[model samples]
Target chain A: MGLHMKRWTVNPETWGAVVSILGFVLLWYILTAVLKLPRFDKLPNPVAVFSAWLSPHPQFGLSIFTRGYYLDILYSVGRVLAAFVLATVLGVGLGLLMGWSRVFFDYSFPLVETLRPIPPIAWIPLAVLVLPTAELGVIFITFIAAFFATVLNTLLGVRSIDEVYFRAASCLGSRPRDVFWNVVVPGALPAIFTGLQVAMGIAWISLVAGEMIAGQRGLGYLIYEDYSNLQFVNIVIGMATLGLLGYGSSALVRMLGRRLMAWEGRRRGGAMA
Target chain B: MSAGGALSIRQVTKVYDPEGVHVVAVDNCSLEVASGEFLVVVGPSGCGKTTLLNVIAGFEELSEGEIRLDEGPLALPGKQVGPGAERIVVFQNGALFPWKTVLENIAYGPVVQRRMAKNEAQRSARELLRQVGLEGIEESYPAELSSGVQRRVEILRALINEPRVVLLDEPFRGLDAVAKSVMHQFLLDMFERTRCTMYFITHDLDEAIFLADRVVVMTTRPARVKLELSIDLPRPRDHRVLGTERFLKLKQAALEAVHEEALKAFQAGERELA
Candidate 1:
């Protein structure tokens, strides 16, 4: 009982999420049973839903991963990785320029502001027509989705560095490049990492939307196809899988952030002030 | 320039915004630090005592006049202080870089300006740590240690450069009485051994008298030297010196010169607020 309680209790926030999810499951079950609603054949009962998730594909047997559902998951992850890497590099580079120099801010600020407010998905048709191929179009949308957020965050982080640090470095005879490389970069690192984390989430959001429109293989495409076929169980599986993958990737970014800003963690915990 | 000069400030004045609403911070402040002398400069706030030090250190360009080391015009402060012309400054807040270990803090100057081999610098760093009574705490970060230990690491950092002049800017301001007393003696002993030209600044009359060989008193902003008193007390001076007649006389004289300026500084602050 104690072991069960310990596992169930967890954090209050996590417990609330678990309870709400159970409430949703019960609500669906009651509508089908107590209300005597006409059940669609494609939409399985809760028991059937769980059974379909657990049981191996009888037709494909051991090669069940070859099914369209898993293939879509792989494609979506690949697209996300590609777009995230592109955003990280370009965002950090532009951020450094914007953060370090007034000249760069003056030259680039207006153009960035003009482009940034338009939604990444709005660029989809333009990307489709402009790019030679569909995959490139999807990648362009995802990159745009991530880049603007990353650049803005990076610029703020770089600008927030204490001016006293610069004065101190100058007093110690640090050259301009030396100041840029050693003082500014390290000082801005925690903020840059924060920007990258935000970019990753936005990259996933934009990538899936793009993939639904443009790609045949990704999880987003799989969900849309299942919905069109009236395969509600498969659609539920696809949605759940997307949630799990997004959560896992975000956790990975946060883990890397912890390692990078270990000092900040200590400061937060009252280990040092 | 006529004094047995290691550093000479010749009629140096620092003016802020000279073209518009000019405020002179330090006014024609001519001073000299003889080699191995322990000089203390004391005044109320806004006296430009720090600005005066910065000008000599080459951190600020003087509005007029010049600073010389060994009777030659010194290089600008932001230039890496030259070899054999080293000037180490201990900032008010112990300014030990939080990111570095105590050992690394001490070795920073040698690694950057002195260009000493890493192993050699580490060796000297450990030695200076011992001199500052911080042996065996070398690997700790400044934030991990107490304020007293952090200040000792800062002193070790300054000394590792083997500076001709070591500038202490209110180094004892944050310490408790026991910590300050311990630091005061440790500094005097360390200076006796190394004999660096030390210029210590404080508003505290007792601290100025306890540490300095000669005390230079200053008026409030538009600051100029009010008086210079030579400390005639014998070496290895102790807690007993605080109770002695000679020490009392010296402290009394220093306070008398600075009292009017202290009041003027307060009134000027009020006028600004009004």
Candidate 2:
């Protein structure tokens, strides 16, 4: 708690970022109001947008934000959640397999190399054509984006491990599987996290693109619909939600990583000192 | 911890990258280490001293021949390694797990071997920490300790398992003079208490003379035992031994044996460049 307080007070970066976020809001307000661009005819002013955001569905006597927007937000979150989970399972599992054995590495390398260069957005056309459902296409695109980076990062993590660790573990009477599970996995986790973080960002980008193309629901679909109808305020709201969702989810991951690798943090801090 | 096992390494030849210009590491090496003997193998760097130690520790595959403990093969034929607390190798780097505390690091051997329950391992770990003069710092991470303390922890980690034979591979490479001296004393004290057989590899002639009951000098890669001198020095030796006549004499002899090897090692490297 003291550390948090100290950080809050003394950390220029933290305060700077917060200030910049508010600055962006002010700038956004000025751009629409004071500047009064020709585009303002359809694009509602900040006050109107904020009011719309605040009361998106005022007919039911409840706040529109709390009711209608909540569902859209939930729908967006659900799609990301499903996609992220699928990406993680496929990524980590295949990554482990690729890392552990030479045969798997060789077998997967060519195919992975081919797939990785093509952006997940590029898969939208193929996914739409090949997959039966739009949701499946979105998920496939997210998975493709996440899976390759995870596998590659995991492989690199495994390769970079000190040979002595394996020798030491073996001499300590640890079995092959024990060595892999106990030493290799934990040792490689930091790098794996790097992959996961990148994969998550890519997954978000992919989901957005997929939804824009063919989505029936989700934040991306909502954004696209708002854009075509010139519902500028709603579009801004959708983008803000997406930004918050992506960043918030990533921060949660970082927190989980810290808890899981409490020891690693200590080690790194010591080494730095 | 009393004198227990005799280690006999016979015709042990280690060649790296065999089938493609194999570089011999230990050439037809044969040696007998009596139970509880503290033998230090001294040579110039690149003389395969560490390779010989690794072969004994079962971390390296010997091109030919065998290592036996108590007349039975320690490392099986056509196989690289064998079993038991007969051998434990301490690397040049302390190689402590940065993640584990001093207590946990020392407890690794017991936990790995399943010799003690987790709670029992903690108890044993505390005892080992105390023995190594790190009792108060048991909760401290390996990264938190000084180099001297870290080195002590490494020794304690190795000794925690009570291995019959312990291999020291340039164990004091990074330590300052005072830290090295402390480690020397600690090692001597542990040896006296345990009477476990030891094989220490060092490029430091003084360290070799300072600790070993016997000093085996080696030549450069395709390394062979050039000379083996019995130290017959008084036990529980102190730092004052370094100034003593007998200690200086032993140091001189160890240096002489490796003097030509040092030159040859350098020359061979130059030749490779040419």
Candidate 3:
């Protein structure tokens, strides 16, 4: 255990990641600032973007110092979180029902199949028209992509679970509800988590697309506004923020999955040990 | 000692129709497992022995027949009874719920069935773990354990349910010879302690002879009872008995019966493939 800790403490992986990022940043600096590449020169350099982002009182209307900047982030985050939660609930529930019952699958599968192929962005115009508010429309658009991803993944997760687990559960005196709670749910968890990660990614994509088209607020709208205004530096900031937020949300989901499925990690470790 | 219920499998027939092709899996197979008896069923691979086990476990409703636990109805041709705790089946491929810890897997039945409180389950589960010599490893997941240990845990899982009949469908099919013998001893010890009705299915003749109170030799596909042999081996038997003349005699008899069925199954395989 001590050796393991020591090896990790002086981990090469951290250095490798650091080196890669540093190398990328250096290359970016060289291209725009040093080499003066044609199109690259027009874009804000990484340093300028970082400096502008870090500045409390920046020339750009959006920056770390401004309330507007944080509000945009908060709004975008809120929309994604809300949409993700709803998608998760509906998708997982619908998926499980579809997986567990033949009747449910028969009745609702076609409806899901029809709606599933429609991209989340495709709902933007309809969501704006149908929903009372642009905010609701944007959230709905975000939800659509995530909901489908979660539903499809959750359904596949349920379907992919081995029949042996079902047999074992039944043989163990599990009632129908008991089987669902114990066998079907846990068996599908790994797959469900995979679906959640995918859904979270798509949620961000659709959220950005929806905001660009429909909304007056959020990081997505900020980027579009920056592009229209041609405050290229602010555009970089917006893009960077969206990237970090998307990565962070996916990482959070992964962390939660690991916490819940502690057994999975231990099992792998024990097998190797 | 006889907490186990008597299992009556009367005129059980199972037919599989995949893509409109009728395949008879179990043809009017009737079996009786007396209360607390260690009944081992041996036959060629794919000889409907497992189908028989599944029918008894109520995973499938028989095409034609009935099964019972003591006097309680288990499976009728047109009726779906259960895949219940009374007939816990340890599968050929281990089914110890990988998502759960070893203790959680063993404690599943009573807790899920609401028969025992959480803490009560923990205490008894610990006791079961100790019997399997897997003490202090309750927190480990199913994947962490060796296959031998996993199989042992699976048996403990069934026993913890305190089922009337424990049906094992080739529970030790993949174990090495040494591991298998160790498992056999472990199982014999468990059987002695529990005295639960054991309906063990295996293709191995030696396993049959070593474990059975009575061994039932089953015919090829659409399985039926071809021969029945009572193993009058003394209690608390171990590896030493494997070399005995009586053991050899019983082995030979079972071999002759199973060998014939195996040949027929092989020929059937050839015909199908061609």
Q: Pick the candidate with the highest lDDT.
A: 3
**Which candidate has the highest TM-score of all?**
3
Candidate 2 whole-model C-alpha lDDT, 0 to 1:
0.79
- The ten-residue window of minimal lDDT in model 3 chain A covers A1-10
Steric clash count of candidate 1: 2
Model 3, A1-273: lDDT tens per residue? 555444546479779978987898899899988998889889688889898989887888778989999999999999999999999999999999999999999999999999989988888888988899999999999999899888888889899999999999988988889889888898888989999999999999999999999988899999999899999999989998998898899999999999999888776566631
Candidates sorted on TM-score, descending: 3, 2, 1
Which regions of candidate 2 deviate over 4 angstroms?
Answer: A1-10, A22-66, A121-137, A271-273, B2-4, B75-77, B82-85
Q: Total backbone clashes of model 2? A: 1
Tell me the tens digit of each residue's lDDT in model 1 across B1-274.
1122398877877888889989899888888889889999999977899988776665667777777777677733233233232666777876766555778767766665546876788888887777555687777666677787777777777666667788788988978999898888888887887888898999888888888899999989988999999998888777778888899999999999999889898898999999
* Tens-place lDDT digits, model 2, residues B115-230: 88767988988977776656788778777778888878888777878888888898999899988998999999999988989988888888888899998888888878889999
Interface RMSD, prediction 1? 4.1
DockQ metric, candidate 3: 0.62
Model 1 residue A83 CA deviation in Å: 2.3
Q: What TM-score does candidate 1 reach?
A: 0.83
> Worst lDDT window (10 residues) for model 1 chain A?
A58-67
- Which portion of correct inter-chain contacts appears in model 1? 0.03
Reference interface contacts recovered per candidate: 0.03, 0.22, 0.80
